[model samples]
Target: MRNMLKATTLERKFPLLAVENGCIISKDADITVAFRVELPELFTVTSAEYETIHSAWYKAVKVLPDYSIVHKQDFFIKENYQPDTERDELSFLSRSFERHFNERPFLNHYCYLFLTKATRERSRRQSDFSTLCRGRIVPQEIADKEAAAKFIEAVGQFERIMNDSGFVTLTRLAASEITGQDGKAGIIEKYFSLSQTDTTCLKDIGLYPEEMRVGDDILCLHTLSDVEDLPGKVGTDCRFEKLSTDRSDCRLSFAAPVGVLLSCNHVYNQFIFIDDHAENLKNFEQTARNMQSLSRYSRANQVNKEWIDEYLNEAHSKGLISVRCHCNVMAWSNDREELKRIRNDVGSQLALMECKPRHNTTDTPTLFWAGIPGNEADFPAEESFYTFLGQALCLFVEETNYKSSLSPFGIKMVDRVSGRPLHIDISDLPMKKGITTNRNKFILGPSGSGKSFFTNHMVRQYYEQGAHVLLVDTGNSYLGLSQLIHNRTHGEDGIYFTYTNENPIAFNPFYVEDGVFDIEKKESIKTLILTLWKRDDEAPKRSEEVALSNAVSAYIELIGKDRSVTPCFNTFYEFVRDDYRRQLEQKNVREKDFDIDNFLNVLEPYYRGGEYDYLLNSDKELDLLHKRFIVFELDNIKDHKILFPVTTIIIMEAFINKMRKLKGIRKLILIEEAWL
Candidate 1:
């Protein structure tokens, strides 16, 4: 059954020779060192920071030798989230959070950089020939070891330049990572197999006129090879509208549209070819003259010459390095129908970048062949256009997905883009790092803008993490959360208080736990009495103030001495009106200054038989220091002149008591609608 036609595998015509010490040596003697790059998290960088990152790249790329290729490849693979449900201390809400994103899919990214030194002949090669087009090519030997050593030193400097910037880091890939070993796939294998894992086996690559397919997965290539497809202006970063506001802005890298937004299995390939700077500028100058000579014959020539002149003027004026650049998004899917949809996604993503997407079917095989780890020297020269180094570096995707905080004390938050759960330590670690001096946060937003929603989520998790949380809110924002905790603890916590016509919020001003009346407690009782007795225009006289202070001290001693007597505002009111009134008369206090009858008349509404007797005669003890979660719902009485200030004073007393006693546990107090 032998046929006369010849058949060969990709391995026989493969351009790579061997991988040594994490460096790849190619058949054309190209030496490439690979590194795994770590960039800043997405949505965290500002516009000014983006420019700094671009400048860092400029300094890093300038150190490389002439004719070297800088290939930065970003891989975004669609991966389904697998929740970890085995943690022992997970609360009910935490467990539910795990289930909510059980099978959610997100685009996981991995970035790698390859710095290659190519031969002059290989750098000038065209798309007409490649290892896949011709027969086997013999590997060449490097005669000058000193030049290679110098390049390695320069690469070390390149790595130093990037790491010193504080925004990006580069880790050199190990030998085991560059070439597969011990059942683990390497970068080269992942590129050929189009898989994010080590389990995928090599597939057949079919190069047809209509499409390019690797195994059952069909490839979709979109390239920005021509300058006509580029926008008129470029910048370091662009504005993100989803999370931006008129008062504030959120910035992402300029190439972000084709980055995480594309949402598929794709590789963004960025190439920078470092040619001799002076020689390249001279060549452009000569081409500009040629265009000028043909301007009389065609108006198009005149416009082309002006453009070339502008490019030359900028390069000379700024001392810019002219380099060739090419970018492509190579996506693949096993389903042909899905491949068509991915093609459209890729095109639209490029359009978002203000670029025209060119589906290059004819050059698909060549571009794919050139993407292999050390084989970048075989890239077609015609596919790239010349631009300055600064302009080319702006197109890099300088962001990554969010990272979880390391501290144990934090709130559970969801990643906006991935829907994955994140533990953010906004309080503890921030204080340690000096990012914040204290954990006091002020949230401001218009109504219905999720301000209350986010605060509710934060306080709930904080309570679960053993924090004492007290909230004073005018709206019923924490009702559901409070109810959940209340039921979970079987009414042991999550205490909420609200005022209504049928039932009003009441407190015991004369009650103090542990049978201790300190100076602060005595002062609070005096303040309460003054507020009840004095009008807005009336100021208490000196004699009346001393009389009220004496009344509070006498009642505190009575409660301490007599255990059978229940301590409450009613008992204190009775003591001040009866027992203290006779003592005040025995001391012969002036009637006009003390005004006992007038005080009783003003406070009669809060006495035992008064209309508002329930306002201060509660027996609940209000031991808020022992309670871990408590909320005071003040919406019903926030506008009432009598109740709002009284309720606020009582709430502040409870919080101050808890803060003074519980020193070890974390505490949070959120005040909602506090304007009133």
Candidate 2:
């Protein structure tokens, strides 16, 4: 009767375990905790049978929450100390088993849910900042202008068709399609398939079951944004998660679910997209294996006939493959070559130690180029390019080591491409008469460094070399050089000074294209006139500048480049005056009430471009100093804006094509403070 009662009770607690020693539940559940166990409990019936209890129960308990408790008795009465044959053992076992079984599913469920939420949260933080920006939409303001009206109309049309949540929903759906199971599976099979006969299923989700057999750890590989396409090529569902988006070139981390670190080799075949990633690990193993295999095949000074010789001979039979392998073999053939050469040579040694001459025992080329001892007499006569260069130019040698070898030291060549020959006397070097190599030297010394004294000596040297010296007396500092050259040479060959008084230097932007016009260039004659009148503050009224610019544009079309014929400038001014006359004739405006004098009153409203007034613009001119020389000098004219065009045009018109016309004339146009 008791047996029947106990059996009935046991059956009620776990229906699946009644016929077997244990029950196994295979349902999927959310695993919330950080760890897990395969089995939850064990039970034994007798005192001695307690030994039959498996350790798995104890191990499983280790993973449970700290608050959980286990009891040794159930249906507690005041003092029931039953022995193992004691009813208490069975009671304790039963209760413990029941507790573990019930809690296992709950723990698994929570763990699963925890992981899912964590993964989603991690992915959200990786998205671009632009996604967040869309949440903060602002209404744009529109003005009453034509451009603003068009912008408003466009914005309204866009608002009518679009809703606020549309962008978010589209992005979510797109992401889902990209990471779905079928998509992941196809990509994996495409990249990792090794055999023609093995069929890969589309439901695997880019993850081969064999690759994720581990339950303990995960492996992650990171790639830059430029390589995100790799996951698709590899047939995997793994994706790049952005590390940082604040930078323009963000890198993403790709997590690969490798279950166990030890099983890397078994799943190595899955690395199909790039062999390099897998090869590095494989190479390390291969290299270790090869070295071990090589040692086993070689012993004492003899190669193992069966192992080493046979393997090498077979490899050498395949022509090109043999040649390549032979090179490697030769590289390792140091026993017969390098060691042999080292033992035979001694005279090659350049250094001695402890009063003993050290002999070189190797034919290996010493990487060292040359070294000269303190005794210059000991230098080699059949010198290397390095040594010969040092000897010829009397340069010092500094030893530098090269490559991996230590025997032959290296020397750095002191001669650089920019360095001049050190020891050779400049007087001994050949020279051509009347041809001077020292063109000009700019002295950049601090004040009180005798810069003027040095310059005077250089000037005297040039004069002795037959150069006609022309010293510019800027700041009046070069008067001494001028007097020296004057005292040395007479007539037109001597120094001369030039000064001017009545040359009116004026600057008027109204007479140029905002002062960029070459006044001598009649092509922009209208621009020059307008610029001039504007600077004079005598510009025409609002009706004037507009009417004038329009008429100028038309006249330019009428005459074109042919406007240089003198008739153009006269016509432009005539057209300006006549336009106002015609406007007065039509009664469109009045000239008497708003004459040129009163025109300046409303001058600003009519101005088209920037405004400026008349000032003397510096002009550059080349003054003929001698038969073969010219001095360029600059003076102010109407517009400073005319600096480039005026300087360029004047130089071109006066000296360029007209050089041949000046008979035996040497002209030099000198510019002072030339950057102006």
Candidate 3:
């Protein structure tokens, strides 16, 4: 059987005729046009985005019924380095210092699309003659211009669909050219060269093997009985296993056995051949009829009783449904030891998943067949080859459900399930223009849920993107993050404000710069004062509230007229005590009716020599808007009766003022223990 299989698997090579814009024409006049697609950067893609991408592909295939589409994704490992080495050198003591501290491995992804046009009968006959005569391929131009135009239009439609979801696609220019030692030649040479082994040559037009030595491995599906329930989404169900013994200090986590190959550590290459739906349906109908006939014959003759009964029962249990698809899974590695390890690991994973896989011993023909179009004879199908078709095609590797934000500002974190570093963008959420909504986000979780850790990580990313971030917390959760950013920016970026009774961080709400006291600021100040003075279920009388508002308005006007006068809590208190009372007397309003003495007593603690006097009287020391990151630690003041809410209100008002001042700059205000 092996000898027969070998004889039947003759290695046939095709010559390349000419390379033109957008398409690669083979000697047999088969035109395969290729385009490169850029996958969106996202932590998890939303369901809507997924449906849109899927529908786009479906529509494209539906429009071009005669053309065959091949979608390919290639993932490779790239060593991480400082993005700007010169900038790093200026900051570091030496180049070696920077490399020693900041180098790691991350996965780089690339996606490509190939559309092959249907062959003409005349071209096919001529190609068969040329092959028999051992002559060059006859040059033939693509005859159907309308079909080509339609293909381009379909791609444009897809781009528009993706763009709405924040994904952009561009045409990969000269996709048919190969880059190597010879420096850019027709891709046909790499595929048709007789001197080199087929495994060493590049077969695909858009793909070039630069990082890893050019080679391929043929992974055949030996068993699928274990795949009784395929997941609705595409990705492996693997957990992260600790790679080091010291869990406390070690930061390495790798996927358990099988997942390592599919994740970023190793790359999995897939080539899927989708059969015609109409033909597949026809074959399934015929198979169903044959089964019915066999069942009737078995019951009538009682032949192989037990086997026949099991077959009939199985057929009755599951409805007749099947899909025709041929998939070739391959993994490439430059090192021989690594390749062997990957092959063994892949087999083990398949077994673990209950779907057995066999490494093809006839590597040359199998790998060659994977890249060639309309060549399915190399790998024959078995009875269990067909599967229940899914609504959406699976890419094997789980990707982010939605596209990443358009801005190139994010950090890569390891995905808990796949153990692949996923890019999490924290710059800004992409929303349609004219939409009115709050961008504030809340993180709620039980203890040890990594809420603080996640916030610190996100804040760090925002700072890296040049956004000003202010974090107010009761615990010292951000101290470590602050120090890290401070060191990286050479003590020029991050600032920490720790508020304690003995050494309180001063913030005068009434202190405003000249020309900066807009009505919004004044309103925010009044709101803060009201929050401080008004008790729950104890509303201040309307007259007293009006008096306070008039005092605040008069004080703001006073400060605006005279730039030298600094308005603090004392200034407002004096104005309410003397000027406000005198005006009320003139209006014939009695002091006893307004309860003026109580309002003065409620506000006296925030004045001179009061317990909270330091906060309301002192000048502001930190510029919240200028610094990249500022953290106000309220650990010492969290339990105070009056200070907690007052400090929080002050901080909130200050941040609001800063945001108002910096209109064009993006700012983030994160409040931990916001309920307090």
Name the best candidate (by lDDT): 1
Residue runs of model 1 more than 4 Å from their true location after superposition: 1-29, 41-44, 127-143, 164-166, 174-176, 180-184, 198-204, 207-210, 239-251, 285-310, 401-409, 412-438, 442-451, 516-520, 541-554, 574-604
Ranking by TM-score: 1, 3, 2
The predicted structure with the larger lDDT, 2 or 3, is 3
Query: What lDDT does each candidate get?
Result: 0.87, 0.25, 0.52
Per-residue CA lDDT of candidate 2, range 172-277, in tens? 1122221224324221122122111123432111112222111121111111111111122221111212322443332111111211101111111000010122
Any idea how many clashes model 1 has?
Answer: 0
Candidate 1: tens digits of C-alpha lDDT, residues 285-310: 89999999999999999999999999
Clashing pairs in 1: none
Per-model TM-score, in order, reads 0.87, 0.19, 0.67
Candidate 3: worst 10 consecutive residues by lDDT?
A: 248-257
What is candidate 3's TM-score against the reference? 0.67
Question: What ranges in model 3 sit over 4 Å off?
Answer: 1-14, 37-84, 88-103, 118-324, 334-336, 352-354, 369-406, 411-423, 427-429, 432-438, 480-496, 524-534, 557-566, 575-587, 619-628
lDDT of 1: 0.87
Counting clashing residue pairs in each candidate, in order, gives: 0, 49, 8
